[model samples]
Target chain A: MSEVAVSIEHVSKKFRLYHERNQSIKSAVMRGRRSVHEDFWALKDVGFEVPVGSTFGLIGSNGSGKSTLLKCLAKIYYPETGSITYNGKIAALLEVGSGFHPELSGRENIFLNGSILGMSKKEITAKFDEIVDFSGVEKFIDQPVKNYSSGMYVRLGFSVAINVNPDILVVDEVLAVGDTEFQAKCAQKFRDFKNQGRTVILVSHSMTSVREMCDSAAWLSHGELVKVGPADETIDAYLDSLPGASAA
Target chain B: MRYLKEVLASRELLANLTLREIRGQYKRTIFGQLWSLVNPLASMLVYTLVFAFILRVEPEAGDPSGLDIFAVWLLCGLLPFAFFSNVVQQGMGSILGNVGLVQKVYFARIVLPLSKVGSVGYNWLFEMGVLVVVLVIFGAFVWPWLPLVVVTMVLLAIFAAGIALMLAVANVHFRDTQYFVSIIMQIWMYLTPIIYPISLVAVQSDKYGGLFGTSVTILDVYRINPLERFVAVFRQLLYDNRWPDPQDFLLCAIWALAAFTVGLWIFRRSEKGLAEAL
Candidate 1:
C-alpha cells in the first residue's frame, strides 16, 4: 500500500535548438550539414516520485522544464538518460481530444479519441452514455465535431479523457477549461478520484490549485529539482523565490 | 523485437485510426464512399484512352484466360501500383498530418504510417473486388487464381508499408521529403511496366544488345525495380490466370521482406526524435 505509483530517476531530456527554420533537403544540401543547431538540456538530472493514491503537482515557471518532465513521463518525449517507471495504466490528458478527426462525428470521435488514450473499444462502449452526459453535447453528438463550438469540442475531449479510468492520470493545465459549472463538476470528479485511492500527477502554474489539491509537490527551477516536500511549503518557497515577491 | 511488441500492443489504436481514415476520406462529398470506386474508374478511362487508343500500346492477350481487354490488363497492374503509391504518399505525411495527435498523445508511432497502409489497403480491396467482377464478366476463370492474387496483394502491401515507414520518419525531419517523393513516384510509375508491356522492353533490350556494351540488358536492369516484379506477379495471377513464375514470386517476397526490414530499422532509429523534429 505504501509503494510509489510513479518514479522518475535522474531523468534528462536534451532538445536541439535550430538556429534556422530550414527543414528541407535543399537547405541541408546547401548548408553542407543538417542545419546549425545547439544542444539544450530541457530536464537535467531531475528526479521525483508520486506515492500511490496521492495527488502530485509539478510546479515551475516558464521554460523551467516542468512540462518537459511531464511529457517525458507521459512517454511523448523519451529522455536522453535515466528512466521513468510507473505502475498500472497511465492516461495523459495533454491537449484533450487531440486525435479527433474534424470530419468525424462526435459519436465516432468518442471511440477514436478513447482508443487513442489507450482504452479498448469495449470500455469505450460501456462508458459511452456517461461520456456523452458528462460532455453535455448530446444533441450535437451525431454531428461532425467541426460543427461544434470550440467549448463543446473541448468538453467532449475532456469527458472522454477523464472517463478513461486509468490508475495514474497525467494532466497539464487543462483544469481551467469549460465554464464555471463544468469546473465544479471536474473538481468533484478529482475528489472522487482521490477517494478511490488512485494517483494523479499534475503540471500547473497555478500555485493556489497546487496548494489546495496536491498532497505533495515538487518544485523545479531551470531543469533541476529545487525542492520536494509538502504542497503548501513547496508552493510558498517557490513563490518567495520569485524576483520581486514579498514575504507573506 | 520490443518495438514490434509495442506496435502489436497498440493494434486497437491502429484499427480505430484506420477506420477514421476510411470514414473521413470523403465525408462531405456527395458521392461519399462511391468516390473510392470512381477515382480508379476515372484513371482507368484516361489511361485506356491515351495508352490503348492513341499510343497503340497493345499488350498481348491474357494467355490461358484468352481475355484481350486492354483496360482490364491495365487495371491489373494499375490498381496495385495505385495502392502502393497511395500508401507511400499518404503514409509519408501521416506523422506530419497528425501533428496534434503526435505531439500530445503517446502510442506506437509506427501506427501512424501503418494505419495509412490499412486505410489505403481497404480501398485497394474494393478496387480488386471490382476488377474480379470485371474478369468474371469477361469470361476469365479468375476464381482459381484468387488466392494467389491475395498473396501478391499482401506482399505488395508489406513492401509499400516498409517504404512508407521510412518516408514517414524522414518526412518528419525534412519537410521536402513529401515533395521529393511525389516527383520520384511519377518517374517510378513510368519506369515500371504498368502502361507498356515488359515484352517491349525485352525486344528493345535484344535490339540494343547490352547496356554500354556490357552483358546487362535493359530488361535485366529494369526488372531490378521491385515494383516491376510485383506488377508482373499480379498480371500472371489475375490477368494471365496462371501460377506466377517461381523466381518472380520469390523475388517479390524478398523485396517485400527487405524493404520492410530496412524501412522499420530506419523508422525505429529516428522515431524517438519525431516529436521534437515535428
Candidate 2:
C-alpha cells in the first residue's frame, strides 16, 4: 500500500457569523453591539486520509463542509481541533482570481501568483512559456487581466495553478469552469498527475466526474462526514441519502 | 518570534507583492512610474509657493543653516513626512484591500502591511533622487553625508512599519482606524514643524516658555515627537550638511524599535483570525 500523503484527524473549523457590517468602530458604537456575531463550526469532527498517488474526491451538498474540509487540507483555514499533516508541498486552487490583480498583465500575474504559491522567480521563468501556451491567451498576455474575458481569466488561473507542479493538489469546484476543451484538458491533466505519482483531492458537486476520476471519496452532509470508501460505493451511498433519490 | 521568522522566510513573497503594488500604483495612468516623481515634486511646488513665497520667513541673525530658502528646508521635512504618512495609511488599509488573498490564501499576514510600506519605498527612492538633483542644481550639495541619508530613510521605514503593523491589525477590526489614522497624520504634520522651522518652537517656547506654570519649555515636549527627531536626522544628513547628533539617532532608533515591538505584538496577537476579522 502507498504511504498516506495527507492524514486529517478529527478536524473542525469554526467561523463567526456577523449580523452586519460592524467591523468599523463607528458602527460598533452606533449599534451598541460589542460582540455582534455568533460562532459556527464549518466543519465538525471530520476525518479522512488521502493516500500517495491517489485521486480522492470530497463530495458533499451545499453548506455540507466540502470546501471547508478542502481548505483545511490546503492549510488556508486552521481547524479548531485535531490536525492535518501533509507529506509534500501542496498547491491549492480554492478560487479563481483571488490573488490576481486586475490592473496587472497576465504575464505579471503569473509571476505574482507563482511567487505567492511558493515558486521562485527563476522557476516561473522556466515554466513561463508553458503556462502561457497552456492558458492559450498569448494574444492578450501583455494586456492587463481586466481586459480578459471571464472565460480566459478562469482558464489562465487554472493553467498557472496546475503548472506550479504541486505534490498534493487540492482543487475546489472552480475547475468546473472554462469550456469543454479546457475541461477535457483538465481531465487529461488529472490522468497525468496520477501517472506521476502525485496526489489530488478534488471537491466537486459533479458526481459523474467524481465517480470516474476518484479512486476513493468522502461524502459530507451538514458539516459531518457520512461515508468514506471506494468512489462508487460512497457516491452511491451519498445519492441514496438524498431526499430526491428515493422518489426516483 | 515565530512570526518574525515566517515573515523572513517569505521574503520572496514580500518582494513580489511590493513589486505588484508598485506596478499597480501606476497601471492605468499614462505617466506610469513617472507619477512617483510628479507627486512629491508637485507637492513641493505648492508648499514652496505657500511656505516659501507666501509666508517668506526671513533668515535670522543666528540662523543655524545659512541657506534661508524655505523650499529646500521644507522639502527636506515634507518629503520624509509624506513618506511616513503614506506608509502608515497604506499599511493600515493593506489587509482590507487584499482581502481577496487574505481570505483565500495562507501566508504570513505581516507581509501585507510590510509590503505596503516597502512599495512606498520605490516611490520614495525616486523622489529622493529628484531631491538630490534639485539640491545639486541649486548649488547646495551635501556630498559626504549623502549616503547617510539612506540610513535615515531606512530608520523612518522601520518606525513607520511598526506603527503600520499595529494600525493594519486594528483596522482589520475597527475599520475606522484607517480614517482616524489619516486625520492624526494630518494634525501630526502641522505639529511636527515641517512647514515652519524647528527654531520656531524654540522661539515660541522661550516667549511663553511656561505653560500651565511649569518651568519646562513647550519645545521640550514638542521635541518628544519622535518624527521631529527623524526629520532632524534627515536635515542634519543633507540640509545642514553635517552628521547628526548621536542623540537624534538614539531617539529615532528607540522609537523605531519600540513601535516595531509593540506593533509586532498586536499583529501577532491578531494574526490567527485575520481572515475572519476582515
Candidate 3:
C-alpha cells in the first residue's frame, strides 16, 4: 500500500538458445525441426520492490540475473510470468554508449542519444554545454565517437546519463570503466541523486562501493533472491557464503 | 486514428532522428550530406547510359509534347522507386541499429522506422527538385497536377512507412529478414513495372490469347497493384499533365491506410522480443 517507484512480483525471464539462431526461410522451415535449443532461465520467480525515493542495490555474480532484473524494470524484457510495474521517468546507464553511433561526432551523438532517451531537443540543448564540459572531452566533442578511446567513450556516455535527471536511474557496473577521479565523481553524483529524493538502482561487484553507497541491498544467486536487507549485513552474508572464503 | 495522431504528435522526434540518420551516415566522410543527392544521381546516370545507348531503348510512348519528354516520365518513376527502396532497406536495419536505444529507453519504438521513412522521403523530395531542373533543361516547363502529385507522394510515404515498420520489427527477431527482403524487392521491381509501361502487359495478354479463354488485360492487373495506383497518379499528374484521377487516388489511400494499420499491429506484437533477440 505504500508509495512505490517500482514493484516486481514473481517475474521470470527465459531465453532459448538455438543451435544457430537461424532466421532464414530455409533455416526457419528446414533447420527449425532439426535445431537443438536449451531453455535458459535468466530469472526465476524473482520478486522485489523499491519504495518511492529509495535506493535499491542488486548484488550477484555474473549470470545471476541482476542485469536481467534491471532490464525487466526498464521494460526491455517482458517477464514470462507475473508482472512488473514502474512509475516515473527512467534512465539506464547499463552499458557505455548504449545508443551511441560510432560514426557520429560526440556532439551529434548527444542529440541522438538524448532523443532516444526521451529528452526533448530543448532539454538536450539546454544542458548541451554542461554535458560536454562534464565529459572532459570538449576538444573532441566534434570528432566522431568512433575515434574515442574506451575511457573517453565511457566519460561521454556517463556525462549524458548524469545530466538527464530521471526519476529512476539504473547503473550497471559502468562506474568501473573510468579512472579513479571520474569514479569518485560518479559516486558523488549518486549521493547527490539520493539527496534529491530520486530512486537509484546500482548493480556492482565492488562490495566496498555497495556498502558505502547503498542503504539496502539484495543478493541474487543462481537467479534466486538469497537475501535482502541492510547493505553491510547483506554483503557480509554474501561474502561468508562464497565457496573459497573459509579456505582463504 | 489514435495511433496516427500519436505518430504525428511525435513528429519532432521523427524529424530529429531522421536528420540523425542522414548525418550519422556521412559523419566522417568529406561529402557528408551531399551523398544523399549523389547516390540517386549516380543510379540515374547508370540507367540513362545503359538504356539510352547500350540497349537503344526508349519510353514506349516516345515523348509527351509538353511533358519534358522521357526524362519526366523516367524521373517520376525513378525518384519514387528510390524513395521506397531506401525506406525498406534502411528501415530493416533501424531497430537492429538502434538496439541500444530500444533496449535502454522507453520512447515509442515506431520512431525508429518512421524516421527512416521520413528521411528517405525527404531525400526523395530533393531528388524530385533536381528532376524538375533537368526537365527544364530539356525545355519541358509544364506545371504538374500539383494536388495529385502531393497526394501520391503522401500515399507512397505511408505505404513505405507501413512496410518499413513491419520489416524493421521483424528483422530484429529474425536476422534473415534482409535476405528475404532483398530477393522479394528484386522480383517486386520487375513485377511493378518501374522501367516499363503497364501497356506492355496488355499486348502480352492479347498475344497469349488470355488466361483460359477469359480475357485478362495487363492494364487491369496493373491497376490492382497498390504501387501502380500511386505510380499511375504520379505519372498522370507529372508527365501526362493531367489532374489526378480521383478514383485512383482514393483507392491508393485506402490501401495505404490498411497497410499502415496492419504494419503497426505487427510491429507492436513483435517489439517485446527485440531486445532479447538482439
Q: Pick the candidate with the highest TM-score.
A: 1
TM per candidate: 0.97, 0.94, 0.91
Sorted by lDDT (best first), the order is 1, 2, 3
lDDT of 2 by residue, A72-161 (tens): 776667789989999998888888656898999999999888888778888899999999888899999999999999999988888888
Q: lDDT per residue, candidate 3, B81-174, as tens digits?
A: 7788789888888888886677776567788888888778777887777776765566654455556567678888898888888888778767
Tell me each candidate's RMSD, in Å, in order.
1.5, 2.2, 2.7
- Which residue ranges in model 2 land beyond 4 Å of their true spot? A27-33, A246-248, B58-65, B210-215
Query: Which scores better on DockQ, 1 or 2?
Result: 1
Instruction: Name the best candidate (by DockQ).
Output: 1
For candidate 3, the docking band is medium
Task: Record all residue pairs in model 3 with backbone atoms less than 3 Å apart, i.e. clashing.
Answer: none
Tens-digit per-residue lDDT, A1-248, candidate 3: 45788778998889888767666557778865635789988999988787777777899888899988888877778889989777887877776666687888899888877766667789999999988888899999989898999899989988888888999898887878689888888888888898998999889898878888887889998889999877888888888888886642
**Of the candidates shown, which would achieve the greatest lDDT relative to the real structure?**
1
User: What DockQ does each listed candidate score?
Assistant: 0.81, 0.59, 0.57
Error of 2 at B230 (Å): 0.6
TM-score, candidate number 2? 0.94
Task: State the iRMSD of every prediction, in order shown.
Answer: 1.0, 1.7, 2.4
Off by over 4 Å in 3: A19-21, A31-36, A246-248, B1-11, B28-34, B49-65, B104-106, B139-144
